[model samples]
Target: MSGPAAALSASPAGTGPDQVRGPVITGWSAVSPYGIGRDAFVQGVSSGRATVSVLDTERWPGPDELACLVPDFDVREVLGKKGTRSMDRVSGLAVTAVRELIAESEGAGLPAGGEEVALVLGTTTGSAQSMMDITRDTLIHEKPFYIDPSHIPNALMNCAAGQCAIWYGLKGPNTTVAGGRASGLLALNYARRLLTAGRAHTILCGAAEEYSPARSWLERHTRHPDENATVLGEGCAVLRLQPPGTHPHPLAELLCITTAITHPHHITTTLAHTIKRALHQTRLNPHDIWAVSPSTPPGTTADHERHALDLIFTDHTPHHIPAPGPIGDTAAATATFQITTLLSHHQQHPQPPNRIALITAIDRDGVLATALLRLL
Candidate 1:
């Protein structure tokens, strides 16, 4: 068998949650092209081989030749009939990822009416298609009377966060963060606070984005391949944040997470500052970082962020695995992949450096968000 298949072939019990040390990951799931779960994603990024794959030509065409979107999985298998109707693709991806995380955490068996749990969700675009669909219906169908109000709820960017809290029955500190791509990293940091204050014992934190035709249409004209920028893609990433000693055999710890906003010109420098801030907050050095997981094709202003790494550290990143390389860009999913990359690196080698896993992004609208995350 291959890497991930080999890993999955083993019983989850041998290395499942309920078995590790402090600040454990407890649970995690990714809706990416590399497959679901951290192990599958790590296998693709570490495979060290090149492959070209077609992505969304029929429905959502983009300039890029390929993308790492989730394939071969059905939402119905994981989500039942009643729950599926309330979600948009973005929400679907997120909740699906969260389902896996919960299963891994054994939260799937959460006691009935366990209102102590809560969910903090994040997203750059919650239901782009819902908005587009309404517009198309109004223009083509020529009747506002037939417009569906159900999509109105799904159309909002915060719907993913709200839908998750409703479905999971979690009633804790439910905050929907808005930090552009850094939202995923910030979401985890937000959950950590709930645990710290004893406000919630386990917080489900995540980010999600759905594919949009308009976004793809714009990419064809605006994106630069040489610079490695692409269009919006669909996916979600979820992590279960728990108190330091709640579970064992859990993966990595959430050392700290922080965010910063700056002018587009200062992308790299700003990211460096935020990364150092994360290290400072955790009291560590840059060299101690074993890896830096930034998304590939670092958009215009954000390109400097990667170049800045060269200036700061002599060691080329152990693996320049830009997350979206194995799992197309889902905006917020960038931070999700960042978290997975960090945990994957740790699982491969014991005693990973108390390093900062950095993420930076600048959107076409000129908004930039930079964040740093580390294991505790």
Candidate 2:
């Protein structure tokens, strides 16, 4: 897309910005099939090589399947032995990613006290393996008390977010949003609202999914028979967001977040309107967008997303990037990966400061979300 690049001027409403300022993304970290850290994620996606590979069926006991898995990651390395013993795979990924973000923000002196920071993570069907194990134990043994007590906490949908707070000692508002593929965008919106309400000085926000035996089996059994359904993938990306003007050197400015629920009959129209709303909220025109990342994986969702994009930017074809093909379907982490892709592109190409990019996602549950970001 080509147009006169505009700089960010006014802060979003309800955010209580002393000056016209937007929320800034100061630091971030990731753990993905590429490996640990954001550098690996950037290099892996930039390389344009598919990170997905055939999963071991013997171990997982699922039909033929492929997944993008974090390679050779051991939670013990980040949390030590005792800390990781009771942690599930999802919690491990969340803790490890947050730890990386904190290490990256070292000299910046981030909020160290428990109440100074908030944790908002997005997930879908959290800790499926742990839940299944305990369920099986209880059902097979014919006793409610037969399930392992240590696994009880892992059965909760908010386990990953809750464990993150415990591990990092964050006492601020802790939350977990279950929005399927739209979870990342939902978490971002929630964090923005918390900042707007002045609930916390800083927010550690992101989404994570785990590639486990149970998850793979569940996907194989429940996935639609569409030939182009997304492949299961696992990863996490945690970003540190501060209220606008709080960061001296921010990677990007978050302009706006828009989301809506639509049915199949009105998906295209709804998505188009949602995208337009984001543009209107940020006072940006279609041409001002440097690029866009669509979070639709494949099949009907991809078709709907394409139809909406065609309608929104008819003549001007922005550098639209389809995320799932390159990284597989990360579910809840889809939007986060899209944002990371745009950030990586800005870093490598060094766009004129303030050039904007759009990230849009449609969850499996029909929730459409759009977020506008400006490189800074």
Candidate 3:
């Protein structure tokens, strides 16, 4: 075993309380364009293979012809036949990712389900296709009220989170946040607060997005006319978060997570400030950072993010792990994939103990976020 497989095989067996100071990430799983499990994602990223594929125009009629979709992912096939008659792509992705995370946790001899567990998911919108389809039916049918009752749930933004809770028997806190590209960090921050307030014993924090003609059309119309259109993509990533010492085998310790809203004109300064605040809160200097995973989509926003990072790390250069471009623009799941990239990089390339990794995210809608993690 060599490369990423060898690194993954060398994961720490356990850690002590004194070794980790904040909430620890016990495990994580992702359904990416690369494939379905953590290993697939790690290998796809490590190998740098292309994930973009031409879309079937009949199934996905839109301006964009290519997308980074989960290969051969069928809702009914991936999930099952029962209770999936109306399951949309987004919900299926979320449910599958969460299910994988639960299985990983249980395999590691860790508790995963019960009343003590909570779920927090982030998304741009539920399923644009489902919503548009229902609306179209209502308007086209002779009777205005004619619509599929089963598809109603898929249109709601909280449907994915709700489904995870119901399916996994998590009775604690269930929340859905909408923050565009910064959603993953926002979800992480919300999960940490829940743990601090004693709202739940553990939290499944992540984000999900789906690729569809409706979303593609929405992107085409919303994007700046001058900016180059990005290749839309979709996926989901979920992490099992618990307070320090709750689990001995941690992937990383969450030092701090911070977010802010500012005008687009002040994005660079605001993001720099957010990063500085996270560093201060964690009592870490820029020089302590060993690597960075940034979720800055292409165009003006990417330049702004680069400027912000340059402003903060003027003294030294930390190794940069570029965003998962091979996976295309994951939207809400951008930050989650960014975090996962850092973890995978650490595993493949061993670093000194207590070395920190930084993750920064910026959304066109004035949302900026920063998170610091200590690799274990």
- Top candidate (lDDT): 3
Residue lDDT tens for model 2, 167-271: 878999999998888899899989887777678888999999988888877777766566345677788899898865566778887888999998856878999
Each candidate structure's TM-score, on Cα atoms with residue i matched to residue i, is 0.79, 0.92, 0.94
Which residue pairs of candidate 1 clash? 19-248, 19-249, 20-248, 20-249, 228-297
* Candidate number achieving the greatest TM-score relative to the actual structure: 3
Off by over 4 Å in 1: 1-24, 48-52, 55-66, 73-78, 107-112, 218-232, 299-302, 314-324, 352-376
lDDT of 1 by residue, 1-376 (tens): 5432222121111122332222435677777666666666667557733333576577555455565456654566657788676467777777777767766666433334546676887776566567777778778776765777777787777787777777776677677777666677667667666665567666778887666565555456655664455534567778776554465444555555556666666667766666666666655555656566765444554457666566656554444435655455667667776677666665665454344455555443344444444443
What RMSD, rounded to one decimal, does every model reach? 8.2, 4.9, 6.3
What local lDDT does model 2 show for residue 262?
Answer: 82
What is the model-wide C-alpha lDDT for candidate 1?
A: 0.61
Selected candidate, larger lDDT, 2 vs 3: 3
Query: Tens digits of per-residue lDDT for model 3 on 1-376?
Result: 4432222221121333355656778889999999998999989889988998999999999989888999999989998988788899999999999989887888564444467888999999888898999999999999978888898888899999998888788898999999999999999999888877677778999999999999999998898754556888899999988877677667888878889999998999999999998887766778888888888776788889999999999999998988999999999999999988888777788776677788999998789998888787
Each candidate: how many clashes?
A: 5, 0, 0
By TM-score, rank the candidates, best first.
3, 2, 1
Candidate with the larger TM-score of 1 and 2: 2
